[model samples]
Target: MENALSTVSSTLLSFFNSQALIAAYDVEIFEAIGDGATSQEVFEHCNLPESTGHQLLVAMVAMGFVEYRGDIYTLKPDMAPCLLKNGTQYMGTLARHASKFLYPLWANSAQAIRTNSNQRKETFGDERKWFDILYSEPNDVADFHAFLSVLADPFVESFLKGFNFSPYKAFLDLGSGRAALPRAILAANPHLNVAVCDLPEAVDHMRQELMSSGHSDQVDVYIGDVISGDLPEITQDLVHMGWMLHDYSIKTQKCILANVFKALPSGATFIASETPLLDDETGPTFVALLSINMLISSDGGIESTTAQYLDRLCEAGFTNVRAVTLDGPRTLLIGEKP
Candidate 1:
């Protein structure tokens, strides 16, 4: 049994090593070439000794990360995705977001367990300014949108099947970054007339995406925070919010939901999807790590559970609440106001 446990531990270590390798690759060290670089050039770029770089490059090549052709060290096919910024779905922003804010705070998982504070302020400051930039700034938010377009695509496909968006004639995607979910929703149910609500910059970006996908005729963008004003020129039968509720405290979450609830028509569905952490999980895991990501990573943050969301929906005058699981790391909390 002890040998089996050790083997499991070693396997987990290899996974962590792979994560490290990926993070390093995201920083572009692998493809940092001046018309492509030699091992000595790589050493200079990485600020490491020539011999050490050679050893590392040889191992990476053996591990299928690089191609060794004559003297020039070239990146392998998969390595270029992370190495080239904005190339081949390179999600460098999420990496920067994770490393800059979430990594160190996750170290306190044990302490967070001991004190049950959600470790919001005890570790990373949940109300910090950096998160504000992440959430509200155009470029940072675009990075986040790009990050999600890749990371959440598979999850959306799986989870969206759990709830039926077909009943609603129109949808208002509040805080819709890249229109990824709405795009999927349209693909699934072609009848939906969608309006995306976000800042002006985001709306502008959304327009370009809608045009590219030939979905411009099906959807429209509305500029302005949903909380501050009326939703859009059009009234929506379904108010869809994907992965936005987990970025606020209970009070702010309620406020946002109330805003959404008010904009939606009677019998309309308010769809909110998040990675719900069961209320009494033992300690740090993916959901807990995500809770940390909500902090210093963004302002007005949290990772609320199903129970909490249910209460908020009820308080905001939503009826017939339902929790639907979206595969792996996310779930949909849909509230219908009738």
Candidate 2:
């Protein structure tokens, strides 16, 4: 009974943990205590009031994000990569994104559930679609893409290890935010042609990134919208889209799949990566909660099972549709055009 009660209590108070972490990132507490710092030194460095700053520090310590010994606080060694700004897996961008956008929008989750719709209008007073409002500001767009690239790092590493790219000569990534996968692909399979297609709003940033990385001549950038079926002429023998199918309703997902199918060459391959529910419809806790986040934030987006994804791919004129398990969080749904 005590263990059950503790679990319930922790679940109820999870937001406290989240907010405290976000607060730490907001005040640059983690960065301040990089090596180690006394409480007074941390408070002074962050310009935070001693009293409340101490309380926040205590919360972080209790949450296992920080260690307190000898009156000095230090970021947990294992957490440095995720907490520090310069670390490869830096999560400060995601923390800021959740604090500014997801936290506020989730306040209306109940109403969204009741209405079966997004609460963007209620939360932000903007009735426009999710991407429109999210990408409206340049900073917001940058933050969104930055955090996504951080999240995609693990998947990219796993993909490079587990997937075989030797069969394909040309590779195109649709809706490639940050072009992380494409760049990684180019590095791993230098013999193949790599390209990225994204919305017009995102193409400029991608071009600049490629130019700065000295990949401008190697990787091509094109403007396209999968939902509108406005793709460039399909020449790539292998195409991939990552973490994009779940951003819309079932109908829209089908539309995107069909559009991709129609655009690809007769013998081309297509793959999409997604975090899907289990066959039993049980929760993979994060994806389940993310489905709720989608309910409250997106336009009819929801989580689907692996079988459901394969069905959608088959419906979209894909043959030999199957799920490819990777050494990462996302599952890749592969299909061939015949």
Candidate 3:
């Protein structure tokens, strides 16, 4: 039994943590406090008023994101690498994306649930498809994809290390944001050919990025849309869609699976990586919350249970459909076209 007031206070005060972190990233305060700087030095570096700057730093300190001693403030040991703008593990892009996009959309979560539809119109006054509004501006596109790529880094490592890509000669990754997975696949299996399929809005930029990264000759790029049944010719024996299936409703997911099944050659392998609900429908808390976030922000997007995902794959005419576990956050739903 927890104290009711304590529980209520915890929920009520959660916004303070979010706002403090948002403010810290917005002003690039972590970048300003280089190698343990005093309050005055940080203020001067960030061009912030001393009084307001002091307040924000104190808030961050309370949030355990920074440490203050001897009148100097510094990022906590664990936070330094993950918070600073130029830090090796910087995740400010995710923080920025949350503040700029998700926060506003989540504000109407109740309304979204009541209506069972996205609140994009209410949040941004743009009723276009989620991706359309997301990619409407160049900066927004970069913000969305950049943060997702960063978030996918650990998953990419887990996937590359865990999955056996040796059996396939040609591989294609759908919705291959940043081409991280494809890059690693090519590196791990040099004999295999790798390509990426993405919407036209994303293909050119991803192609340029791959070229700049010196993978111009090794990786191919194709334009495709899985939802509308518009897909590139299938030459890949192993096709992967990473962390993408949960972004749509069950019907659309089935459509996507069917489209992939139709596009692949007989006996080709199809894999989709997703963070699914447990069989008991308990909580992997972040993924559960993300389902609600999807409900509020996307068009009929919601997370599914592993059983639910496997069922959809089977319904799509995939033979030998099954869920494979990796030592990572995402579970792989695999099937074969027979």
Candidate 4:
């Protein structure tokens, strides 16, 4: 009973942990201590007042993000990759994104649940849709996609290993944020034609990224919208949409699937990657919490079970609909247009 109560109490005050980490990122505390620094040095480097900055250091130490010894502090070795600005798995963008948007929106989660609607208007006084508000600023768009790419890294590695791209002559990734998958596929199967289709606002950035990565000539970029049915004529034999299906209402998901179905040629393979709930609708913990985040911040987005996703695929006139297990956080729901 004592342990259970302690867990509950910790859960209730979890936001403190999140805010402390975010605050550290905001003040560049992690970067300041990257090479080890005394509290005074860290505060001076970040231009933070000594009293509050010392308090934050103490909090970071307690949170295990920093280690304090011999009057000096250092970023935890394991956490450096995620905390440092130039680290391979830098997550400061995600932390800032949550601090700027998700934190405020989630404050109205109760109202969202009660009304079965998004809390965008309540939180931001913006009546526009989620993406409109989220993509309103260029920095926000960059941060959003940057964090998504970081998060997708693991899934991309797993997908490449677990799935075969050799069977298809041409591949197109729909709503490919950062076009990570297409880029990876092109690298692995240099002979196969690869392309990416995304919203116009995102396409320019993706094209620029491809150019920077020297894939501009290798991979084709097209502007398209799956929900609006404005997709380009997809001649690709295989189409992959990553972590996008759970971003909208079931009705809209169906519509997106239908649109993708219409765009693909006969006998084409389609794959949508998603983090689904367990079969019993119990917690995968993160997916369940993400469902609430979607409720408050998105257009009726909710996590579905694998079975639910397969059923939706089947209903959209997809044949051989099945869930493919990958060695990553996301499940790949695959179907073929007959």
C-alpha displacement of 211 in model 3, angstroms? 3.1
lDDT scores of the candidates, listed in order: 0.70, 0.92, 0.87, 0.91
**Arranged by lDDT, best first:** 2, 4, 3, 1
Return the clash pairs for model 3, or none.
none
Question: Mind giving the per-residue lDDT tens digits that candidate 3 earns over 162-220?
Answer: 88887789999999977878998888889999999998877766877788899988899
Which ranges of candidate 3 are over 4 A from the true structure?
Answer: none
Where does the lowest 10-residue lDDT sum fall in candidate 1? 125-134
TM-score of 4: 0.98
- Cα lDDT for residue 38, model 3? 91
Clash pairs for candidate 4:
none
For candidate 2, what is the lDDT? 0.92
Candidate 1 accuracy as lDDT: 0.70
Off by over 4 Å in 4: none
Clashes of 4: 0
Candidate 2 vs candidate 4: the lDDT winner is 2
Residue-level lDDT tens digits of model 1 in 139-191: 66666678777777776678567766766788777888888888888788888
Q: Each candidate: how many clashes? A: 5, 0, 0, 0
Task: Provide the lDDT at 206 for model 4.
Answer: 88
Error of 1 at 114 (Å): 13
